[model samples]
Target: MTIFLGGRSRADTGNVISMDRFRSGRSVSPIRQAEAYWSALRRHGDVPNRSDIDPRGLENILEYTFILERIAPGVARFRLAGNHLSRIVGMEVRGMPMTALFSAMARAEAAATLEHIFLAPAIAELSLISGTNSRAVSQVEARAILLPLKNDLGEISRALGVLVADGPLGAGGLRFDIAGSNLRKLDIRPDRSPAEPVPGLAEDQAPIRRNAPGLRVVSRED
Candidate 1:
């Protein structure tokens, strides 16, 4: 996979480190581990299937990992989330839109980024910063990665992700702004086509389901 570091912009002035540097810095071990696991699952240049994920494979980073289900264009919700994610938002995050963790101004961009991952079937690594007004009140720095996955029907509608933060999570209800992002398109063989647009994929809005005691990997039967 090719890696590119994004340049600092006015909005991301506080983001001094780019994704490439962040990866090399080796501070976010969970992100790296998750990427390695996802990469190892690929066969014949195709994305891994959701059912193929075994919680044991991610035991080390399970608390920082999550699964997402695409529900609409540019929209996805957490199918499962680890404890660290709940701690960040001060609530269980299952069934909540992924953008809920982002600031209002950042949601649009975050949604677009999510869409690109599913539509292009690409892998994305994002640099995030969370604090009051995105200026680091708690001085939290985070790295997140999104790896596409296929559903039981063989459609690219799921994702496996990892989010790790460094610094004191002083308070609950933290929201992050995207500092930088890098995307690598997957190599889909001519025998397999990219995911097609599915109509009526949006589910009815329902209450967030409470998770069990720990991280649970759903099988195809569920």
Candidate 2:
């Protein structure tokens, strides 16, 4: 597997501090709201377990939601997917590599991001576009979210995800063409250390709080 390095220790090899492709914006869709709801469940620095997810709680966004299970280092497969996800591919998406939904060109990066999410226990958000091809002529644009989840054993090898298409989808089988992606590493460590003070700020001066929660990858096509 390809390895990415960050400034921290080997123990943190599973994590990254940040990346350049991140952007901050308003949360406009039901999918984004779902992510916020998931965030609200984290109490006492615990990564929410798959068992903790209640399908009814996501009824509004349920069609866009999904769950993934890590099968190997840096690899995850769909354990369950929503109707909206199945409709995009014109078939059930369970048991497939999460990359199956991505365009050929974007699959590698998508896989890498999944790895980052699992190993680093990060939250990943992506802006995606689907290719125009036979059976599906019109292109589709969408957004996707992947958040880390713990398994029954408490290992951070599961993910909770959601995909929301911005426009009407073509009837033909469709796949994603990644446009941009952002990753935010969560500090779910049990200790939950306080953030260090920024330089040049007075001890009494409150540090400017930026809502940035992640790193990112801007697609060349964008």
Candidate 3:
């Protein structure tokens, strides 16, 4: 497997890997498959709704798939997660904050990156490294992607993601550090309508005042 690590300018053409390479291989990368699935759902540059997702579409990569719900600024908790994530954390990870998988030093950045995904409503690709301590038994590298999703209420507070790690996962829970990241802002067409109407009640029409300027208020019973 080709591990892409280190600093590469986002503008560099080499930073982008073609999906064709995986097509030529026996097994395609789960990350690429997840991305392709998400991209296919987009219509006219609009973000896909969470309801539109179907597990059958991601059958091959479901083990690496997850769904996140934004709870607060820069914070998100896993709404649904797969076995691969549980294996890394050594526990059921559903309902846990997504930052739980990151080392203390990396959590802040991870949270910030997550916030950007929902706020900018962008797509993010991240590179991660774990088990790099001197006493660690093995080093594991990973690639993950975050694709924004709209909830039933039409709020952009949900996300669909996939994380795929390469290398032997050492015993115990693993915490990864952010190695690199890239963001692609969603291209929302100007003509696209708002996901939902303005919150609260609709505007009320003001009562008209008579031209006499001395209108008196009277109860109907009177």
Which of the numbered candidates is closest to the native, going by highest lDDT? 1
Residue-by-residue lDDT tens digits, candidate 3, 1-222: 122223445555465443332212322378779888988998777889999999999998899999999999989999999898888777899999999888887788788888889987788888777835512367666778889999998789999999876656656488888776777788677555567657686676789767657776789997
TM-score of 1: 0.76
For each candidate, what TM-score against the reference? 0.76, 0.71, 0.74
lDDT of each: 0.82, 0.74, 0.78
Candidate 1: lDDT over CA atoms? 0.82
The parts of candidate 3 lying over 4 Å away from their true place are 1-28, 131-136, 190-222
lDDT by residue (1-222, candidate 2, tens digit) is: 223322234355333323222233322365577788788778786788889899888888888889999898657888998898888888888998888887776677787888899887788877676776525656666778888888888898999998876555667478876666567788766865788888888468567656545755669996
Q: Show model 1 residue runs off by greater than 4 Å.
A: 1-16, 20-27, 131-137, 190-222
Clashing pairs in 2: 21-216, 183-215, 184-214
> Model 1, 41-112: lDDT tens per residue?
988878999998999999998999999999998899999999999888878999999998898977887888
Error of 3 at 51 (Å): 0.4
All candidates in order of TM-score, best leading? 1, 3, 2
Residue 220 in candidate 3, Cα distance off native in Å: 24
